[model samples]
Target: MENELTLKRFVDIRRNLGYTQVEFAKVLDIRNTTADIERGRTKLSGKVVAELLKQFKINPLWLFGESEMQYLEPSKTSVIPKVVTVDSSDNENMVLVNAKAAAGYPQNIQDTSWYKQLPAFDLPLPEFRNATYRGFQVEGDSMLPNLKPGEWVLAKAVEDIAHVSPNKIYVIVLEDAVLVKKIEKAPNSNNVTLISLNDSYPPYRIEPQQIQEIWQVNSKITFGVDATTEKGLLRQLQESMEELKNQFNHGKS
Candidate 1:
């Protein structure tokens, strides 16, 4: 009963804390071992548990099953459940579209019937709750300092042309090719200009009618890893990424 209570408490805590196992592990200064905790195959040290109790002010009775207590006084807010359901077919060939693809334009090729035949594996998709992946591959060196050629980027599919923002990066399918570029809405017109991050390419404006599809890029969690022992490394990395983005924006301006 005590063990069951512990497991239940852990689940409750994790849910309330709004952390995926990976995020929770990072917060605990545990590197890449969240799966163990979730599986109940590993136990946290007494010191770590105590720290959690102290920091979170969790109900000890609920955690240890000393009493029928369920609620903690200083409660953490519940997180919205985010689940990613992948097709069952493409499990084995499930590749991370990390960089842009240098070959054929994935976005322009609308015949995804081939993908349906591949075995599928599901990953706990990242926290971009409102977005869906519209595949795009990298090309050229415009986004070079940050994105490399042959790396794949997952873009959020947008149905409306009005949804595309000015001066924001987007994955666009134009006729036979898909390209990633910064888009700027033309003043008082339906046309939009495509701008490349690299200065070697000249900016080109195109009418909305010329586009086949447009996708918004949300570049969070392009990589996955387990827990780590490094203190605040995740936080630091997030900050660094933000800083890099700002620097890129400044340079482009």
Candidate 2:
């Protein structure tokens, strides 16, 4: 009986997504197993379940007959970026958005040729290996002593708005402007409050509809800073402190 319910629910998922059996299999990249599982000739495997969770944001408990909820929150759906550029090898390249291009980014973001014209490169870092990344030039003094003007911030696209972590900085793309700000979840509301590291700029709230894209700031690049300068030394110290905090959290977990 449990198996029957799970199989029925799985078919319902395909219908809900408006995908045929073949189409759903293509999306999950498991064409071989999809038909078998749907017909009850085989049981669903853990790997398939993981893929469904990662791709469709489907509620795992519900699929297993453990809960009544059929799906996770709609806000958890991953936002697929448009007009992404790729290298000759077909690997994704991180596109650079300098201050000049940023001004027109919001309006021309969907233009494929615009992305092609932007400078792009690939990094050998492990953390950046499996994700789409983009670089944005920092402008103004809004971020303050931590992120200086003219520095470049490399960020990965958030899988979903619901996955946005609080107290971290993000490069938020809006219809009219692009802003790099710290995020704070507004209590009991779908809107978010954008905060700044520098107290001079007051925090502001924005509705979800205003957000075009959200990229979590991962690391930064700056030139002409070495061990001899105060700014360089401060930057090193900050990196070290953050590394230590991460290590401590990992150990605790």
> Top TM-score: which candidate number?
2
lDDT (0-100) at residue 195 of candidate 1? 88
Local distance difference test, candidate 2: 0.78
lDDT of 1 by residue, 1-253 (tens): 1376687778778889898888878777777856676567777556657656777866565577765645544533221111223545633222222233323334424445534432222323333334455444476688766667644465666755656786567877665566788888867875678988888889998866567667777663322332121233234335545665677678779
TM-score of each candidate structure, all chains considered together: 0.44, 0.65
Candidate 2 lDDT over residue span 136-218, tens digit each: 88999999988998787888988667678886889999878989998887677877889888899999998777788889998
Q: How many backbone clashes does candidate 1 have?
A: 25
Off by over 4 Å in 1: 1-86, 89-108, 117-121, 126-130, 220-253
